[model samples]
Target: MPKSPETLLEQEFGLIAELVHAHARARPRHPALIDECSRVDFGELDQRMDRVATSLQRDLVDVGDAIAICAAASVNYGVVFLGALRAGVAVAPLSPSSTAESLATMLADCRAKFLFLDEHVAKTMATVALPSGLQLVRLDHSPGVRSLEAWLAPAGSVPVPVTIEPDAAFNIIYSSGTTGTPKGIVQPHSMRWAHVRRARNFGYDNEAVTLCSTPLYSNTTLVSFFPAIAGGGTVVLMPKFEAGKFLELSQRYRVTHAMLVPVQYQRLMDREDFDRCDLSSYRMKFCTSAPFSAALKADILRRWPGGLIEYYGMTEGGGTCMLLAHQFPDKLHTVGQPVTGHDIRLIDEQGRPVPVGSIGEVVGRSAAMMKGYFNQPDKTAEAEWYDAEGKRFIRTGDVGRFDADGFLTLMDRRKDMIISGGFNIYPSDLEAVLFQHPAVRDGAVVGVPSREWGETPIAFVVLRPGATASADDIKQWTNSRLGKTQRLSAVELTTELPRNSIGKVLKRELRDRYAQASS
Candidate 1:
């Protein structure tokens, strides 16, 4: 019999792939992964993983070498990721939505020996100059290409086992950089183990079913993905997010757990048939990645069926704060308290710790932090902060203050803070007021160059459908509710705001557009 989940996790460090294989031994017939096309049970899933590992070994891919995957989420993708882990290879999951250049840069940055992709991603990457000696394996069947099915070793193949240490590189998740090549964040096995162990508190077990709406490249998706398998649960992967499809699958699979960003929640709530969907099976719903508004939290609490949790932290693994929205309705504005064993503090511009209630840059230290930025020691050093006691913490680049009750209220990203007439302004504060306008469907605030104040705030408004609100009318109304320093210089009407795949408003894009228009 396989070891129990709790016993395996009780070790100093554990391998995710080993834990998954253990589950296969314990419950071979149980469903382990579900994608749009097929369902894979634990028994078959384990065999597939072994075949992938054995094939990599045959290719002479050594332990700790990296491989890259650039495809939509699918059963084969999951197997490749797990199999690489079993062979002690770190998987670099690249985003398909990234520009071809950016995608190529990431593949090169990780020093991958193989690039696993689907026909769709292959067409997009046709223009990319692939690194020399990098093998291409198609996840889907393509007549002329090397396919994953053909690449796999014979049935019953078993790879030579290897040890995975606490500090061994597990995966390299790249930052969402729009400009040059994004830096790869190297997360270790110990860090992922910490996430899996902490996930036990959220009720992941053999019976748990997790629905993942985000792409596999994102850490947002993996946080829930790894935990489900480690706990012997079933994971349902979506090719792309459609609110209606998500609701349908949630009810179809009786999904018990989910990790979603805030905008996804907004879309789900806005669906005309939302109230009709049977979401009563959800045990817990998680939100992260961007600022989750208090209003949205309350809306979900009033209408949604399960406990809602909002996590506040960075992908680099710093201090984390979690707000159990169901338990603290009155404290909806704050992002709850720092999680257990995470030391989160605020520091001024000069790196001094701020006073108890003062707003400063958020810095945190935790057992789950990343190893460092891959191949970029200087960039890694720039993201670190050492306390007076010489302990290291990752800088979160956010400005926030702690309330008397220890809850954190985020102000803004330190880089996003606008200086108007020598006074500081948080765009979130202005955006909150903009959201209050009845005719506003979506909005954002950005600072533009101004000769008078050095910089002045401008508003971008997406008016509600069929609403006859002019930019001037919205600006007048917004300014009427604001102080002199916070008033907008202009309000430009737009159909929608540009956002990244995970729903963070692309403020840099908005700022650049405004600058070019003014010029």
Candidate 2:
């Protein structure tokens, strides 16, 4: 008999593959993964994982070796990701949105022996020179290309099991940035285990149906993906997230849990047919990755079913804050309190802890923190801050203040803060004022170099459809509400703001655009 899910999770060092295999044996007929084209049961998933591991071993890919995958979300992608874990090999899931040059650089950075990608990514990478001797496996079937089915071992093949340490690399999630070579964050098995352990708190179980609409390469998707499987739940993967299609799949699968970013929720809420969809089966919904507005949270609470949760943290794994939005409607403006066992502290520039209710940089230490940046020790060191007592914490780069009730109110990124005539101006405060304008649909505030004030604020506004509002009209309305130091110098109208794959506004891109236009 296989060990129980509780037993495996409680172990000092447990492999994710072990838990998955146990579920396979205990409930062979239960659905484990569901994508658009296929539905895989735990038993079939287990056997396929074994075949993948065996094939990798046959290829001389030893334990601790890394492989790179760039593809759209699919059952095949999930199989390869889980199968590599079974073989004690780490996976680096690269973004298909990255430039061909970036893809080549990341493949080289992780020293991957195999590159598994789809036709789309293959076309993108056709011009880039890959490392010599690196094998290429096509995730989707293509004539003359090595397909995953061809690469996998025979169905009955069993892989040689290897012990996985708690600290071993599970996956390296490259940082989400719009430009430059992104650093690969080396997440360990232990960090993922922490997420799995916490999944129960959000009601994950065998009956749970989790809908994952985000790309598999993002950490936002994995945080919910691993837990659903570990708890023997079914996961529905969406290749592309269209608001209508997402609602259709949710009702079809009776999805109980979903992890989505704020923008996705915004789109869903804005849809006309959202209320008609059968979302009553939903037990819990999660939001993260970007700033979730208080108004949006309130709207969700009023109309959406089930409990709502908002998580605040980084992929690098430091401290985490959770806002049980349904329970604390009054605290919607805050990011809730520090999660249990997560040590979150506000520190000044000199590394001293800030006084009560004061704003400072957020740093946190937890059992789930990452090992470091892969092959970039100096960059990793720069991301870490050691306390006076010698405990290390990941620097969050966000400035925030804790209220008397312990909820954290984020101001802005420490680097994004505008210093005008020695007065600090938080863009969020300005953006909040801009959001109040009925004509403003979306907005972002950025700081640009100024001749008189050293640095001045500029507002980028996306107006509502059919709303007749000039740049000057919006600017005057917003400036009237903001403090003198926080007023915008100019306002620019745009169709949309640049955002990363995940929903963070690319402020650096906005600033650069401003400079180009001024020049």
Candidate 3:
């Protein structure tokens, strides 16, 4: 018989290096990564990573030192990431497209010592003044920067030895905070392996050809990548997600699995180019970050005719719940039941468990949860807790409910709820109704300040190409579906909604922009 969730986690937790080494030995000849530039096998990947490890040691990089990686998705980035972890150094992978201000803030927050940047990003970084105690190295080319190629040059000898513990920090992923400054969610080596185990159970297998359309720096990519590697599968990397190119690559590479946000799906489905490419190669499709409307979900199922999976999670907690296509017929809006080893509960504001079907905060305990925020003990303590049963659970800060069948239906973020004319409305509920319109491609409902109501919802919409619809038309469409108080008072049309690295709509940024324009 298989071990229980507690026993399985207890035994496997914190052994990332060992796991990777084992995979290297087992599947050395297997294709590990395929990018636009080249494809690398496990044997080559292992050898390159070892060389990177030796280089870091030669540079006198101490254990636990922060190594920031600022590059696009490539084989070099993957090798450097694994090498840093193997050398017992904390890795922070920042988006290559990030602004100077954002990059500087993350560098200072993590106290990163050495940076590995792409040639283009290096040129940009050279113009900015770096913080004290920092040194920059180019992954491709730059002056005074150690090139990744030169650093990994043929060296038959290994350097100083390093030891890594399960609980030790592995990586710091910066969260896209809706309110405050972005916090670095510190994940340990063991938690990463746990993520791999969970991902394997979630459906990544040896035969899977996982498509890497999302930014590798995001948690969605990290969770998917490690498992694909563990299962001896190949990862097809896309520099960035472009709807037409995405479909072409999927068919060309025969990609069997993929992860995407709802907005991407909406955009792809609306494009005329979607019909020009073949997508029958995709077998597994997963989405996260935000809820998808029933109409959108139905459209995807009709288009792909493949498995569709929905996962509800945050940067802090890897994945709390998952709903698969098999379960969609009945639990259409549900985020699915808890995976093995996760204990879930919906609680009221007073910290008491709410009755079934009551809207409340969703909290859970799992092996995939992050260790804590880096160097922020108070924030960590506030977010983490041990239940009366001694199971560790992290507060999700999302308002949701469990149905009689024990499936979870997320209502909205507690902070995202809108109040208008002394009435409360959930943006997701309103957005779901708006998505039913044939003209709407993608939409985000945000609370804008109002003179009468404390805050009213204003819809920002992206219409389907060649499908024209006015703001008033959409407003009337929503008003018919929602209550008088829940109706949107205004609508704005845009080509695209502003999104962060992970494809999450930055509602706060939208609100700020609207406020400025109105003032």
Per-candidate TM equals 0.82, 0.82, 0.76
Candidate 3 C-alpha lDDT tens digits along 33-143: 888888888777777777777877777788888889987888777878887877888998876655565577788889897888887677657756788978776765456
True-structure lDDT of candidate 2: 0.88
lDDT of 3 at 288: 74
Task: List all candidate RMSDs to the true structure.
Answer: 10.6, 10.5, 11.2
- TM-score of model 3 vs. true structure: 0.76
Model 1, 1-519: lDDT tens digits are 667766898886788898888888888999999999988999999999999999999999989899999889999999999999999999999877665766778888899999999887788779779888899999877455699988999999999989878888899998742224468999999988999998989989899999998889888899899999999999999988889999999999999999987767888888899998899999999988766678989999999898999888777998999999999999899898999999999999999999999999999999999989999999899999999999999998898999999999998776676755434456776787789899999999998876455568999999999999899999999877664557889999999899999998999899999988878
User: Which stretches of model 1 miss by more than 4 angstroms?
Assistant: 416-519
For candidate 2, list the clashing residue pairs, or say none: none
Q: Write the per-residue lDDT of candidate 2 for residues 1-519, one digit (tens) a residue.
A: 568877887776677899888889888999999998998999999999999999999999988899989999999999999999999999999877666766888888888989899998898778789987789999887555699998999989999988888899999988732234558899999999999998889889989999999889888899999999999999999988888999999999999999987767888898998888889999999988767789989999988899999999988999999999999999999999999999999999898999999999999999999999999899999999998899999998899999999999999776576655434456776787799899999999999876455578999999999999999999999877654456789999999999999999999899999999999
RMSD of 2: 10.5
Clashes of each: 0, 0, 1
Relative to the unseen true structure, what is the C-alpha lDDT of residue 435 in candidate 1, on a scale of 0 to 100? 91
